[model samples]
Target: MALQRVLAVDDEPFNLEIIEEILEDLDFELRTAASGPECLDMLEEFNPQVILLDVSMPKMNGYEVCRAIKSNPDTSHIVVMFVSARGSVEERMEGYSVGAEDYIVKPFGQGELTAKLLKLGHMLLEKDILEQQVEDATTTAFSAMATSSEMGQIVNYIENIANIDDVTTLAKALINCMSNFGLSCNIEFRINDEQFHHATSGMCSPIVLELFEILKSKGRLHEFTSRILVNFDYISVLVLNMPEGDSEKHGRIRDHICFIVSVTEQQLLAILTRNELCQQQQNLNGAIAMISSKFKGLMLLLDNNRKQNEAVFKGLQEQFEQRIPTMGLDEDQELFIYNKVDNAIQKSVAREEALIQVRAAFSEIESDLTALSNKVDEK
Candidate 1:
């Protein structure tokens, strides 16, 4: 890691000496100034990460100097820590209220000063790393957005089309995007037999509508005078009032508009796909919920049948036990009949327990499915 810079501003020369002696052994590049004005001057070249300021100064106090440093965007990021003899609560509060990160007393230990500075240094390093990561991510996103050889501004606008969900907003966004190329445009988009129209200034004239109809019928690109019309299966874009004299510029503009329209048609397809997926998801969720409800009802019926079967088995076992002693038979025969009844009762109980477990398992699965369905709906 690079050495962090430290700027200490104190009117007292002895205090500056103390600070230098303590911090000189550490991993820092330290500089000192005798007054507030001198400190401000040194800040230009010595862009320190942390500033050790003394509260009492000659012309400008530490508060004033700290405020000046903070108000300027260039130097605002530097950390300011007050090192002064005024250790009262109010004095420390005053220092902090003016944007000081820390307040240290006059009789500070070397270890205390080193610990504070080290913490601040680590924090500044982390902050720098975060800022760099954000800048890099932004650069990558923009680069990905402009993969084609089109205007960067228009590419950015085209990239945002996937995020738009409403037709009216999409129309407005399209108009704004074309405005960057200095073209006055209007759009007529249709989806599922619903029509949406937007223009930059006034309502589109009847001639423009007629031109759109003519292009749609012919299924070809058309350029008449200064107006250009491009038609697709679902949408049409009309670029009007092109600069008439510059044929080269007009041709380029027309080509770019066509490219944009092609990309927009793909986006419209995505919108349609998204809508269809949402509808399918809704239908699937409803089906799952209905199945879950029916399964719960089945579980209740099974439970009732199991209870009735258990009661009948218990009653039969009781009757067999009560009549066993009274039956006139050999001892061996009586013992055999009792054993048969006991075995049948045990089998019945085990089967009922298995059914209960199966019902519980089904209930758990239904709960999981319901939760998953809700999550999909939220998305």
Candidate 2:
């Protein structure tokens, strides 16, 4: 197999020699450029996996070179590193601002450069495979005809499907365009739990299907859709997946995936919460029954005690009249019995009010629970 390519750009011969010497033992094909323009020219013929650029160059600095490389679609995906004698944090940040993968100080060891290159090489390989697949699938050789009514219709179709909630509709529209415009690929799609689901039709071989399953298990709300587009010749698309490091640029990628993952997680949490609410409703029902039963027993006991006391009070006058005279009691004793009767009536009234409040609270809890049950069912 051919070795991975590395492009080293520096104005100083000694620095270039040092870089070359550091990688002399490594197993890659090394290419050297003395300036930014020369590096860009070499890129046309030499597709290097990584570009190690010196920051302080004469005509075009490392930042400018990085900017140029990134602006061009052909070299944008290539990994770039800026090397400099001025290793201040500000300089490093500037290098990164221009799309450099890493910033290396001039006095760096061979192991450090080698390690960085290895990591960047793997990432470049993955990006290349993905970009190639997308390019091949999108490329077409049809004639460029003048704009017509059909163009307007196609634009309208794209606009309408662009914002639609249904992924299936959008996927179908995309496939229809491919078919009508003599483009490659057929699309088939569905909606799984409010998110889009899709697969390239006529290319669902075991490997492709397995890829779909892996993505599905990964779940919906993905920042962007993972798609496979086969050509008119039914050739399968191969996209490479690269794992990311903890860098800000990497975070952007993670942020996208996280947004989708959160959507799925939110949906799942809603489902679980609904189930929990249902269980709570069941528990609430049992509690209400117990409260009602206990309150009814208490009310019955209060009523029985009230009736017996009423009977005693009614017969109290005769008993007092007979016993007070026999025991030589006065009218003051009769006054005391009336006072005791008033106190008992006041206490009974307070107990009745408390029972009413308890009943009211039970009704409120029942109403709220019913509302929650409806919400769960709607979900």
Alpha-carbon local distance difference test for all models? 0.83, 0.63
Worst 10 residues of 2 by lDDT: 231-240
What lDDT is reached at residue 57 by model 1?
94
Model 1: lowest-lDDT 10 consecutive positions: 141-150
> Which pairs clash inside model 2?
221-260
TM-score of each: 0.51, 0.36
User: What tens-digit string does per-residue lDDT give for candidate 1 at 1-379?
Assistant: 3337999999888999999999988978899999999999998898888999998998999999999999899998889999888799999888888888888998899999999898888778888899999998987676555434347766687779879876677778778878877889878887897766778885777776776666765764777788777888888988887768866567767777888888787887777877787997889888898988889888888888888888998898888779878888889998898899889878888988888898889988888988888887776
What is the alpha-carbon RMSD of candidate 2 to the true structure?
21.7
Which pairs clash in the backbone of model 1?
none
How many steric clashes between backbone atoms does each model show?
A: 0, 1
Candidate 2 versus the native: TM-score? 0.36
